[model samples]
Target: MSDGPRLPGVEREADEDRIVCHVDADCFYASCERLREPELREEPLVVGMGYEEGETIGAVATASYEAREFGVESAQAISTALERLPRRAAFEDGTLDDPDLEREDTGYYRPVDMDYYESVAADVREILHDCAGVVREVSIDEAYLDVTERTAWEVADGFARHIRDRIRREVGVTVSVGVAPTMSAAKIASDFDKPDGLTVVEPGNVREFLAPLEVDLLHGVGPVTARELREMGLETAGDVAAADPEPLVERFGERGRELYDRARGEDDRRIEPKGDPKSFSRESAFAEPVEEPDPKYDLIETLADAVADRARREGALYRTIGVKAVTPPYDVNTRERSLPGPIDDRDLVDRIARDLFAEFEREPVRKLGVRVANLEFATADQTSLAGWESAVESDPEPDSESEPETGSERESGAEPGLESDPDPDPDSEPDPASGDRLVGQTSLADFS
Candidate 1:
């Protein structure tokens, strides 16, 4: 999130306005599958996690709209989804005619292929960069673009249509776009029509556009908050918008004010193009939590190499090397070692990450992560560690016995990286923090 577009020492107008567009790919993972095998376009598809060679259970990552009709949904256990939508193979030998098969539709299951989807996402992002002066990539399948200076409100719809058409023509995936005066409104409008839909809310219509919608449709209003709002007799955005500000503020603190403002279409957050990241991290989760040291160390080695490779590609260096371990039931612990100055030493990253992660060797670890932070972009130099003892003394290690926090326990914000889907795939597990991009203030619009 940026404070609008501003140069150094320049004052921004208090009433500055901009045209923001939120573009979201439709059922991205499923769409990618259809792209690969066009025969599956009409077939119900379910992409799952943990579906390897001898696994009875996995989790649903994404389901095609057809699959959703069968009550299959993202994040539901694979076993449950299978019960609702039987595998296509079940019907291959004339089993579809069986009276005992309650399901009317059979579905295909594919393991999540993150690398392939990422490659597709990169193509989409390239087009976004060309379409706007500033583009904020929220996740692999969604982004926000500031096109205020590029096009007027009258032509914004046409502008959006052009983008949608191009993506379909070039990338083979249809995208829904919402064009509005604010990011929140844009997000809602984009989802207002989905699967290659487009909706534009003119400047003055923001309030009316949001007023009749359910409160849960608003950004950051999750199930718990929606329930609370309904319990308070605030059923729609209109209710929140018209309620007394003081009571709402007192009840929800600063967030209440944000809710009120958003209901009234008052978001002023800018479309900040992701700049240099504060850190580089790579993570992988186990199919099942492992308590052994060798497997965990092997994962650490792979992650360290990945992060360091990314840093080298960006011509960046770091002074801190850190490792993260997530114990069973989602407890997260992080440890880091900081040097006096930044250095892009790959071996050093590997060694330090392993040293930091050594304490968690015997713990029931569900996930592992390696991060290099305190970044600087300068040429590498051989610097002596004469001051290493003092540096270590100044920055004491964290308590090794402390209970780790879950991913949700940490602060939420947009991190600089190619946003990956939160859902894990069997072959390529995602970082526990991977899906944070999809949940918070900057998430893709949730039409449902």
Candidate 2:
């Protein structure tokens, strides 16, 4: 790594030669089933919820390759999958309707064995961690590995095969591995050939490799977006890449530009692990920009209550309460107050949010939001105001007919940093200290 002088607020450049590897297990749940019951291998197996040897009531979780031949798919209704492929157990004992049903046409049905599958996934996860310097597990069965530090492009395919072989040999399950210079391309490459497949897209060949795929094949492009893209005459990745970007942007905002970029092999994202959320917030847009105080404050109070409830449910204590008010012409103005210490006080969250947003209550606001930040999560055993970290809110339940708090309940003296909070301006400085820890605060009100 170069010892370059790093400045605050400057974006870091993406490494062009970085190798990203996407590993996805082949029919993970069914594969796990086959691990214990070796007889289920290459057999038509269906793993789902509310499904037993004789009963069928819930949804399908996963269908093996053999089962999928008869139109079985994930998230499909259990009854629907059963209609296409009746349960083999019922057919064998002369129970299923229509006695002429062949044994080959029928399939095995198993309920979701999450605990066993998780154990199998843990073994696979260990192998992935050992193979790469950085791993981003997208789900239980698939992950992205940053192998740039581990292997070179010249032998990338062989390195990918080694990872695949390790999982299959050690864990008794097959995995498809895709290696590429970019994350988007790597993701597409992984699904190129399913069921124990491996594909590698070198540095310059990412675009060509992605060209022939359909629009929905790209990550984040779902059924609705793909249909819209099709209406715009962009049926394939190449179509989107070659079309005018102006129309695309008008249709889908920033995501349209992202689709165009990914179609052209222009993703700069690096592999990073998912982490705990920094803050929790909830917001709502008004039917029209309301200049009235009552409607605006009502929304703010509602949002504050919701945000606080979320924090309490998640076992988090917050030290900051904030409000967002979007004024006319799409300008987002925000204000927040930091407390002396973290507290799971719902009333306090509402109090501070309304106090901070008092200036914008009468202003023409198009949207309103409430947020709580500077969080400290507690364990399951610890939950209280003073000592325990895991305290659920102990507030009295409000009657359905009770009117909302309109700043009349607050006592004279206010919490420190809550009163006389400065608005964001060119000359003003943000409040950097809340309690023992540094608070990165932002207030957008008035210095005038």
Candidate 3:
């Protein structure tokens, strides 16, 4: 008996046997901005990575389609993007020779706000979960849904349209969807028409659907691979599909065989639902490296508070707390401590993270992070209440002759054996821009 279904001869009936949908948010970051400021919808907008005052170097996270028409692209340096699509200030000041012609064309710029984007992503995920039995969240802006049981080719287009419309109406952001019999084909179809596109490739058409596309358009085929494929006289996916698999395998190894299979629309991957996160962490990078121990310790406290708050929101208790310190020139040093049991104590997370970070106190640090791992979602009774009570009771009482210290004083003063660190001003806020680039440069393999 065969272990499973055979491949080459299966295509005759495979088209009608499966229903997979890939949904990609159209210009996700820019769309998120438009949701906040509707006026930006008509204007060219560029969401860059630097928004903090005096920060001049960063990359363009995403540019609206209008901005892209002027040669702005995601991952391009912010400086380069400004040259193509000058800032509003530049237009207002008549800095360019064609200032009158480009004055109204000045692009709106906003810093990346990850927390806000994540909140928007959560809303989109909720809608996806409602659409299919199994929905795989690939990233903040992409997902794949297995709707084989919900709809067939006959109504797949309508189903996809409903998803697109609902996302626009409910979430205030547009998504492009592709419905196909295979995951690989579905992903490609999703990008067929973008910025609110819906493309469907039914079972029998999968081969023809992928045939005329460039080899580089296929998932997993990068620039170098595309060039090599061209050298082998394979310019389009059709050429690779028809080429000898053994020679391709010999040339590119297992990846060559994968290329051939994907070229023929043979992906069998399933939609895997998103599960609980493995860990929770918060990291902060300094605008400039600092040698002072006080600033580093203060940043760690802030990171610990953020992580602990997230854990509490998720009703999770962690047994391990860790700290990451990135020194000058990008050397990462990490230390973790595992507790006797799981606990959700925020103060404990702060103290443990600080203790773990103590070794690098005097080092010039560029970034700091705090993380909690080994998570348990059970009730608080799982922790050692008796031990916690004993530890708290063991603290020495304040001297009657001394004045009581205020909360701010206690926070600023370090415990015995720990170096004193200045508390950061509560009014000062860090830039919310994240390190993640936007959806435009993401690979098709990411969705698969």
Q: Candidate 3 versus the native: TM-score?
A: 0.60
Most lDDT-accurate candidate: 1
lDDT of each: 0.70, 0.69, 0.68
What is candidate 1's local distance difference test score?
A: 0.70
Instruction: Give the TM-score ranking, best first.
Output: 1, 3, 2
Clashes of each: 1, 5, 1
Cα lDDT tens digits for candidate 2, 1-448: 3222222343334554888998877887788778667788989988775555555446666789899899986656677788899988988888888867899999988766544555456557656765776667655676778877666777788889999998887667998888998877887788888889999999898888888999888765766788889999999999999989989999988778988998999998878755544566776667778998999888888988887887786688877677777665445566776665567877777776787788777789876877777778877453334542223234322211212111100000110111111111111221233111111211111100
Off by over 4 Å in 3: 1-16, 50-56, 93-101, 277-448
Model 3: per-residue lDDT, tens digit, 1-448?
A: 1122222323323445778998878777777777666777868888876533466677776778898888887666677777788777656766656725656667878877554455455556656655776666555677778877666667778889998998887667888899998777887888789869999998889999999999877866656778889999999999999999998999888888888998998987766654665567776667778888888888888988988877786678887787777664544566777666677787887887787778788888776878788888875464543456455346522211211111000101111111111221222222346432322222112111
Between prediction 2 and prediction 3, the one with superior TM-score is 3
Candidate 2 versus the native: TM-score?
A: 0.59
All candidates: CA RMSD in angstroms? 13.5, 22.1, 16.4
